[model samples]
Target: MKHLTILVPDAQTSLNTFACIIGAYDIFTRANQHWVGQGKDPVFTVCLAGVSENAVIQQDIMSIRPEFRLSQVAGTNLILIPAISLDFERPEGGNIELTGWIREQYNKGAEVASMCSGGLMLASTGLLDGKSCSIHWNAVDKLKNLFPRVLVKTERLITDAEGIYTNGGGYSFLNLVLYLVEKYYNRETAIYCSKIYQIEIDRQNQSAFTIFTGQKAHGDEVIRKAQAFIEDHFREKISVQDLSTRFAVGRRNFDRRFIKATGNTPVEYVQRVKVESAKKSLESTRKTISEVMYEVGYADVKAFREVFRRITGMSPLEYKNKYNKEGADLAAMS
Candidate 1:
C-alpha cells in the first residue's frame, strides 16, 4: 500500500479537495495519514500534506499532545494539499513551510502534487516554473499577475506539467489522487481505487497545456544547453531557429516539442522570464522605466509598456508605485 499525507493549518479545518483525496486514495488499497494537533507522526506516514478543513481543525493540530514540526516528512512518498489558507491572501506562513518540505521531497524523488489554490504554493517555490502548471480560474489572475515566471494555465482536473501536477479545484483532487495511484501501481489498481472511492475516471480530454509526462530526462544534454540559452539571453530576441540549430533539429520540429513540453512557444516563455525580471527590478531598484526596458532587452518603451500592461494588467509605473508604497510601509515600521 502507498502512503498519502495531507497537511493543514489545523486538523479540524476542512478544505473540500484535500478531504476528498483522503477518501479517494484509500480505495487504491493505500493507507493514509493526516497532520493533527500540530503533531505529524512521520514514523507512520507514507504521504505528507495539508487539509481543507476549518481552522478549528487547525487549532486541534496546534494543540497536539506534542507539537507540529516536519518530522515525518522524510518518510513521505507523496504529498497532497487540500486547498490553501483563506485568511492569508497569498501563500505565506505555514504554507511556505509546507511548500519547502514538498520541494525537499521532490528533490529526493518523492512525487509531489496539489489541487486548486495549492498550486499557488507549489508554483511560488519555483517548483512549477519551466513546467506545465495550472490553478483555479478565479485564482489564476492573481497567480499570473504575480508569478510571471511560471506557465500558469487553466484546467478542469489535473495538468501534469512534468512531475508537478495541479488541478482546478477540490473535486479535481480526486482525479489527481486516482491518477497517482494509476501511475505507481497499475491502471487496474487505479480502477479499483476509483471504484472504492466511487469517483469517475473518465474525464474529458484536457488541454495539452495542463499535463506533462514529467520533467526532461535526468541528463538530457540538449535541454541543458537550451536552458542555458534561455537564462543567458531570455530578455533578448531569441528565435526558434536559434534554439533549433543548437539542438540540431529543424525549427518546426523544435517548436512543436518545446511547446508540447514547456507549454509556451519559445518567444512567449522567454518574454515571461523577462517580465518577471522586470518585476524584480521594479521592486528593488530605482531605475527609470526606459533603463528598466533596455535592461530587460526591450528598447521600445511603448512596446514594453503595452506588453507589461497586457500580461499584468498594469503599467510598469503602476507596478512600481504599488511596490514602493509597500516597501515604504515596511521601512517605516523598522
Candidate 2:
C-alpha cells in the first residue's frame, strides 16, 4: 500500500483547506475500495497529519484532529498540502520547523503535491526553487514577489516537475487529485473516480478564468506616469518611442525600467491596458466585434483576435458571449 499523508496546516480556517482535506481523504478511500471490489487489496494507506494534535481553525468555527502528528509520521510515499490561507500569518515561531520536516521527507524519497495557495507553503520548503509552479492567479503576483526563485505559471492548471506537483487556484484541486489518482493507480480507476465525483477529466488550462490587471505597485514615478498615460489613452496607437521621448528617457532604458517596475514590457503593458478596456466594452455594450476592435485601436480583425486570445485565452466573440449581459438576456429569451 502506498502511504499518503494529507497535511492539515495549523492556521486560520479556509473553506478550501477543509474541503480539500475531506475531499482528498474521501476520494482516495473510495478509490482503494474500487480495487477491493475488483478482488484486490486496498492500494493506499492515507493519513491526515499535522504539527498539532488538534488544529483550531478559527474561534468556535471548527477544529480537526489529525491522524498523525509530524513526529509520528515515519515514512510517507506522498505528501499533499492543501490551500491554507490567502493572507497567511506565519505562525508565532514561523513555519521553519514544519518546512524542515517537509524537506527531510522529500529527501527521503517521498513526492510532494501542493494545492492552490498551498503552493505558498510548499515553496517555503525551498523545493520549488528553480522550478515552475502553478498558483492561483490572484496570488501569482504575491508569490512572485515573495519567492523570486519560484517560476509562477499563470496559464497552466497543473505543473509536475520531477516528483513535485503544484496546481492552480480554487477548488480545482479536485482535478489535481484525479490527476494523481491516474498516476498512482491506473487510467481506468482515475476515469471511474472522475465519473463518480462528476469532475471533468484532463483539464489543462486555467487561463480562461484569469483576470488580467496590469501591475502598478512599483515606486518608479516615471513608469507610474507612463502606466497612467496608457490607461487614459488606450484607445489610440501609442508608440514606445513616444512614451520614452515624452518621459525624456532613452528607448532601451525606458523599456528596461517599464519591465522592472510593471513586470511587462512597454508594448505588453499598453496591449494589456487596451485589452482590459475592450473587455469592459464587450461586457457592457452591444458593440460589434469590429467596433470594439476599432475602439481599442486595432483596425485589423486578425491582429485584434490574436492579441485578445493571447491575453485573455479567448477570442473577442467568445469573451463577449461568456461575459456579456445582453448576450445572456438574449439567450434566456431564446
Per residue, candidate 1 scores C-alpha lDDT tens digits across 1-334 of 3455555543212445335444544543341222122243322234333422222233322321112346544556666665664333445545556667778878876666777677766776778777766675555655665576777665445677556767766466677777776676557656765676687885632331232222333354565567568877877777778899978988887777766555557776676667767877887887777888999999888889887765555688877776766655665688
| Candidate 2 ranges with C-alpha deviation above 4 Å | 89-94, 324-334
Reference-based TM-score of each model: 0.49, 0.91
Q: How much does candidate 1 score in TM-score?
A: 0.49
Who wins the lDDT comparison? 2
Residue lDDT tens for model 2, 1-334? 7899998777644778888888889999999999899999888899998887765454356666787788899899999988877886343232456678889999999999999998988888889999999988888877887788998898889999889999998988999999999999899999999999999999988877777777776789999999989988988889999999999999999999999888789998888888888888999998989999999899999988998898888899988888998876886799
Supply candidate 1's per-residue lDDT for 253. Answer: 78
RMSD per candidate (Å) reads: 16.2, 2.3
Q: Model 2 lDDT vs. the true structure?
A: 0.86
Where does the lowest 10-residue lDDT sum fall in candidate 1?
Answer: 205-214
| lDDT values for all models | 0.60, 0.86
Error of 1 at 200 (Å): 1.7
